[model samples]
Target: MLQPLPQEQTIMAETDRISQLPADIVDNILGFLPIEDAAKTVVLSTNWGGIWPNLTQLCFAPHFFRRLKNRYSTKHAAFYVITKILLQHQGPTIRKFEVDYYDSKTETVKSRSYDIDQWLLLVTRKGVEEIKLHLGSQEYRLPDCVLSCRTLKSLDLDSLLVRPLRSTYMLPNVASLRFRSINLDFFSDLVLDVPSLENLSCEECYEMFHLHIIAKSICSLNIRYCSGRELDSFIPVNMDLRSIRTLHLDSHSLQNFVDDCSRTGLPLRSPALNVEDLNLSDFCFKEETQASPLIRLLHICPNLIKLHISLWCPVTWRCDSTYDDEKDIPSVAEVDRRLPELRSVAQRHKRLVTLKLILFKGFWCEMLFIKELLAALPSLQEVIIGHSNDMDSKRKCEVMERVLHFPRASTEANVTCI
Candidate 1:
């Protein structure tokens, strides 16, 4: 008999050890892999053949459907695969299910809508706890069974027009809710009655005229890019965020909403005042010279422990003293113009300890703004300055120098750059 090689002997021993593991242990190992990789295990060994059907989590994303380019091919292939998987699944409960059917073809989306809904119904009925669906551009009305699923703990909808069956939805157990690139018109019907929701985010949604989020159980609320210039004049977005502890808002939307509240005497409640952290971004100081919307947030979030802000400043303000509008750097005279507005709001920030500034371009106006912030927030202990990746090493060094030397109202404040 030919002598067995040492390597071959070791391989056989390892395979035997793995094969001896408990079925549940093997299933747990497979669960850690992506759904696509896990499916390949069926051919690896007999132990995996029955395992796929009992997987607790299923994630069939668009990355696996890349080969089927056109509408018909993807729709047919995805439908057959998902249907077969769900039909063959033997588990009594699925913990999580996520699908992204974002094809460009409108007809393909329409063709697969019913199949997707059926799959959702099947899993949700099986006591799935988390469901995330990202559909194409067309309007895909969600089934009533999914909207009313009491077992669902989390729901995420993206890039689809959601038309609930009824005027109001009551998801009693859902705690985390997110909507991205959705029609904001549905917020009234969708979010009104979700009593257990604690975290909510509406980002990049369109056509938002009025926001009426009044859920008292919410602890974190993020409203970004939804409130814009096109809001209908009659209904101002009413934000009732009394119970929230974390808040993130785009500067322009916050300014617009605040102005509207001021005009109508609508008492814009300082929800950020109660929050532990606040993030304000996506506003250019050049656009407005009035009370800095960002500074206003720092002042109001008195309980805040962390603060993040992103500002647009001129590159030449740090590199060259001469203001060149030709180089996109408004004159230093313009910086002088906005200094008083920034200074007017500069005051003691008693609770802030950590400050993070994103996209530091080293403009003089930004320099003055940082100076004012340092002069105000007395409790600040750490300042993190992050510059854009496009910035060169020399420019990064310059920006670091500017931040390090700025006078600090807090004696222990330290500055670091990234």
Candidate 2:
């Protein structure tokens, strides 16, 4: 083999290595870029010209069109660019398609509904697996084609209206479903039939008067800031989550379920017996009434191995008077009386190994709660404590020292305070 001359070697070193990459690798790189940036690569070199048309993922985010020349409005620009790309795309399959239009006006959404429907129709025909649509707070009825798309594996919708579906429509392959700020028609029972769904999340959604989830394959469920039409007439959430393993319920949703159960004389303990990890946010132990619901929720998950509790600090915790030693610290007997339900539940949770407490203020109530948890959980191996930002350096140090001295049920338990 003969070595090249110095001039030839220098020329070889300056060659466009990225442009010379294999077709599949180049397609992947283009797929990760914003549609606009990826489209621009077509002019870079002849090798990249065909790569943009074969991109498997297309994302038309608001910021992508925001940088365009102001010849047209953002909405119109997005419409033109996305339509052009889809029309030019030669890919055999689209793995993901996302349209996030947060700045859409109500009239704009209504006017563009037909365009969105066409987009969905084209993408569904190309076997799109994941579809995410964030069409602002307006209610745009999704095209019927999306409901019957068998190739869809994940569907995320925000601010849309779901009308009653025909019995023939089903999402047979969807494994993950997410909804935010959606309005559901009374006859729509779409969620009840997703047999392959494994993860379900609903956030800030309302007007679900009779939400029933009956997914047997679901492993994770998250509900946050969700409510029904009328509190007095709202029906309780009915779920058949026998296979659920991880659960998250915010304060409002949990309280609503508890209240509904109480009113209907239904058991507060759910059928989510397989849940091993539980996360409760905005939880407060300041009132005795609050303890009952927490206890009932724990009872629903006997196999829980990890527990995360974010204590809701009231205005009283920030007052200067709350720092007084005599007034702030409760006696041992008082602590037991105030938190008897928690103690009972903690004793029964022998399988629990990890405990996380967030927004800890080191008040006497919180300290006693920590002490009770430390004494009760014999299998607890890790304890993570996140102190509130309101605490001063001196106060944090004092709290850490106090926690370090607490007796642990597990000899190997490691405690970390931050």
Best by lDDT: 2
lDDT of 1 by residue, 1-418 (tens): 9988999998888877876677678776876666778888645776567777888888877775664445455457877778888998998988788887676777766777788888988998899889998886656777778877889999998887776666666778889988888776655544446778799888887656544543666788777777444654322233445566887778656675455545655444343347777777764555553235554554455578887887665443444332333346454456556666455444445777998888876655566667777877788899998877656798778667867887888898888888
For each candidate, give its TM-score against the true structure.
0.81, 0.84
Clashing pairs in 1: none
TM-score of 1: 0.81
| Model 2 C-alpha lDDT per residue in residues 1-418, reported as the tens digit of each score | 9999999987876786777889788777877777777778767988777777788889887777666525564556677678888888888988899988766467767877778888999999999999999888555888878878999999998987767566445678889989888764443454456778899888887765545554667888887787765765233244545577988887776766557655766555543367899898887665455555677777767789999988775755542222235454554355457566777677778789999999988776677678878987788999999988988888888777988899988897899998
Q: Each candidate: how many clashes?
A: 0, 0
Q: Which candidate gets the maximum TM-score versus the true structure?
A: 2
